[model samples]
Target chain A: MRNIEVCFSPELIHLHELQGKIVVVVDIFRATSTMIAALANGIEEISTFSDLEECREMKDQGYLIAGERNGQTVEGFDLGNSPVAFLKKDYSGQKLAMTTTNGTLAISKSSAADEILIGAFPNLSATITYLQKQKKDVLIHCAGWKGRFNLEDSLYAGALVKSLESSHEADEDGALAMKSLFEKEGHQMKAYLSKASHAKRLQNHGIEADIDFCLTLDLYELVGKVENEKVRAI
Target chain B: MRNIEVCFSPELIHLHELQGKIVVVVDIFRATSTMIAALANGIEEISTFSDLEECREMKDQGYLIAGERNGQTVEGFDLGNSPVAFLKKDYSGQKLAMTTTNGTLAISKSSAADEILIGAFPNLSATITYLQKQKKDVLIHCAGWKGRFNLEDSLYAGALVKSLESSHEADEDGALAMKSLFEKEGHQMKAYLSKASHAKRLQNHGIEADIDFCLTLDLYELVGKVENEKVRAI
Candidate 1:
């Protein structure tokens, strides 16, 4: 059996060896969830940038510049980090240039991995199936809020580990703890995640609808893969 | 109400501002547990060092050198990281110089905090009462295994948060997740921790008794406070 490990935040990513492992970057509050939704809803490709100015400049190249900082859409960007917003309309034949407070930063730091996959509740089963087929060690890198731990991404990690338990042994205590957490709270994810700091932050912004949409599991049957810094549904 | 946050690993310490928070450093599997046991059983003070050589040299200054590396006792140490060993004898008036693979490193890194207190299951109530009296913003620093998240310390964090829930607010998602974990598994902690990687490592060293001893709740009614790098019961 292969091994599964969880790095609770991008800050803890240095403790993990990314090479030869499948790194699943998750920002369940928005970023990765939006990427999966955008790709699954007919967006051609998603290119991630860490700098807001850099991401906004993509509009000049005929790209739909999408980015958010601190949960609000950056001025002049086409969209904010909302998975539900991405599903509102079809963008077939269009490319997305994206950045966010946490998600894109995590993706940028995950370049050394053998493969990078975007993970969130939207593509849970699809990502599981993809990892099972690859048969490599998996590392779930959570895009916690500003280098601190967050609940949504960690709960997603637990969900992945629970589904992959039979095929992958937990490589550390973080994995085991997350697996137990999923087992305890998986059935009531919406209620449990409502207590998360990010959830409250979004609620303060009157975006409770987005939080609910992001927590809906297995909404898409496609997996988001990152190649050469661009994400596409596979 | 004061806020309670958890830093799941020493590596994540930089994400937190420790200058004003009351930092509670925990290594539940042994380090802090043993420190609590030692102080409760009458050891005058415990001085911690991260380097084994630096800790070992304390023997020349009439201090009892107790240290461990990788779950095993280093050569020329008086004791391994065992709470049970400390409880077996009265070490009244004796000073202890100690080092461990994870715990001491966490304590050393927490110097910027308003105060540092050693936390473990054995002194759970004492520490809780102490923190409640202090009424400061609290940060639980888990001395995770090799700068990675560990179940035992994080579980202890959950226990503290749960007990302090009435008077403290969860500051971050890590604290919230840990509170849920402790609520789900606190009653059966011994059985639950049996699955932890550090627990397995200890079992491999034929120290199953140590694990049980470390998990025993409220065995001591004193808190270990670090003042000028020397830990003493206050």
Candidate 2:
């Protein structure tokens, strides 16, 4: 049994440490979820570029380009970070290249990992089972709300830890804190997260519908894996 | 029945929001605990500053200037953030002007609070009692380790929340999570907290001695509060 160690923020992680490890990148806010949705709907593959200019080049290459800046779809991109918006597309056999403010950055940084996959609540169970089978020491990277720790990401990390059972080892206080959060609160995420500052901000921005949609679980059948800087659906 | 809020990060607060309320600024690492020790040992008053340059200037003004960077004493100051250091000088009828990376920023930002107070585990009960008597909304600002969530601050917030009993309402999920943490794990803060990420970091930095000092309970008789951009013992 390989050790399963989860990191709550990307800032705290040293990329060299995760080398040759099976890493799962979780940005539950909307990016990972949107990516999963885009792939699940049969988008050929997603070229996740950290550079907006590269994403634009891919868009110009006749691909369905989806990108988000500050949680909204970039002015010219075909979609935004909202998981719901991607579901509106007919991605059958089409390739998608996307960029996001936080999630893509996290995925890009984990390029040295042995394997990198996307995770969200919708695919949480599947992700866990697969990781357990791979049985490599797993590190769950929480894309914190802009270099700051947020309850939503930590809570999700906690839930993953809880579901993984004895395979998990919390080497840091954040891991223990999330474990405590899960042990006490036990995963009523939507209700618990409704009051989050970001959720509140998003609600105030008229994306209230997306918040509800984002909270829904098991909506996508896509499992995204990072291959050569792009997450292609397996 | 005053409102009690939990600030998970220092970024969420501005100086203006704390005006005229009993704001509890917590830096469980060592600063707040040192304040509790100095005041409890019959120190007259305490002044908090965010700038080390200002602290240097205060030394020339005949005030004791003590602080730390990277958990060690500043090269020229009278003392560092260690509670052990504060116990050396009898502060009766004297003033302390201090600066630190985390706690001092919390003090500066909360200068507008009707009364801003330092909260640490050593004086946990007394701090809660003082806030209870004041009978107004209490905001627990955790001076997270370098501007992010730390277990010690959240635990103290949980301790205060658990102390409020029927008199307080759970204001937000951060508080609720804290309350839950306190309920389940408050009884063993040291065993749990001494193992915290920051605590371990301190231990690695050779300041593990300070950790033991910070976790002590009810060790001080003085309450430290802030006014005019300074923390003065009241």
Candidate 3:
């Protein structure tokens, strides 16, 4: 039977061990959400970078830049970290060079995985369907707040575990715990997330709409997979 | 307001910042349980060490030695990682020098805190009472499975957070997520932990009773506090 595990934060990841596993990086509120939104809105692909300067350098190469630090838009960037910012944007053939505090860093660190997929509430069902079809061991990599576990990401991981529980066995305590949280509180994602630090941080920045948008389930039918340093629809 | 945060694993701890905070190190499977049991059984104090050699050396200095690695008792140790082993044993006025795979390591790493308290289900109410009286910020440091997040510790942390929720606020995502898990599964700890990897590991070793003992709430009325490298009742 395929097993499911959760890496609560990117810092706990052992890259070499992920070599043959399927990894789903969840960065709710809002990196993964933004990525899903950008993809659903017709952005062709997104190249993720850990450094803002690296993403900035891509601007000259026809990549639109989206960078954020501490929940604020990075200086001189085309977009902030809010998913709502990506709504209705037309980029059918354009590439996005994006950097965020946690999500991008997680993607960059998960290069050893056989396949890396972006996961968020907006494309949750699609992501689950994609994983269920793969039939490989799944590792939900939560892009926690700066190397610490965060509620929003874990909640998304819990939701994923809940979806996969019937067919997959939780491989560790982290996975079991996450699934339990989802079972208890998955019905009220937005209300539960309102108590999260990141949600409050974003709320302070007047992005409540983005929070609501990101928490919406199945907004997109596409799966975002990291390939050649870019996240593209698969 | 008193703020509660949980370091889901020892690896996520930022030692320098933990200074001046009230930190509770939890290793529910055995170490903290053992410590609480030893104290309740009249052991004078427990000196915790991350290095096995340090614990072994203390044996020569008249300290009762206990050591565990990978869930197994180390060779030449006086006791294994079983709290039941310490139960009912008369260790009056004798000090214990101990090392464990996760618990002792977490305690050693949290020495920078203003006050370091050992937490386990056995001493749950006592620890909670102590924390409530202290009326300071709390950080539940879970001794995860070798620097990785684990379920049992997080569940214990969640229980702590839940008990203190009326007066304390969860300061971060990890704490809130843990509390959520605790709220969901706290009532069925033994049944829930039976599914945990560590519990299975211990059961495989024919120590199922230890799992039961560790899950027993409020078995001891002592709060084990770390001071000068020793954990003693306060």
Please report the candidate that would top lDDT against the real structure: 1
Across A8-32, the per-residue lDDT of candidate 1 in tens digits comes to: 8888898889999999999987888
Please give the C-alpha DockQ score of model 3. 0.67
| Deviation from native of the Cα of residue A172 in model 3, angstroms | 1.5
Candidate numbers sorted by DockQ from highest down: 1, 3, 2
Native interface contact recovery, all models = 0.78, 0.38, 0.75
Q: Which tens-of-lDDT digit does each residue in A59-159 have in candidate 2?
A: 77889887767656788887766777766757788888877766877787777788998877777777776776775777778776665455666677777
Question: Interface RMSD values for the candidates, listed in order?
Answer: 1.6, 4.6, 2.1
- Chain B TM-scores per candidate, in order, are 0.96, 0.90, 0.94
TM-score list, all predictions: 0.96, 0.74, 0.96
Candidate 3 residue pairs in clash (backbone atoms < 3 Å): none
- Could you give candidate 3's per-residue lDDT for residues A156-233 as a string of tens digits? 888898898777788578889888988988899878878876677878988888889988998778999998878899
The better-scoring model by lDDT among 1 and 2 is 1
Candidate 1 residues lying further than 4 Å off, grouped into runs, are: B70-72
DockQ per model, Cα: 0.72, 0.27, 0.67
Query: Per-residue CA lDDT of candidate 2, range B1-234, in tens?
Result: 666767766766652257666788998887888888877766666777778898789877778888887767799888887787767666777777877778878777776677778898877777777877876778889887765567888888888888885666664556666887889888887788765656777788787667877877776555777666655666
TM-score of chain A of each: 0.96, 0.90, 0.94
lDDT score at residue A166, model 3, on the 0-100 scale: 77
Best by DockQ: 1
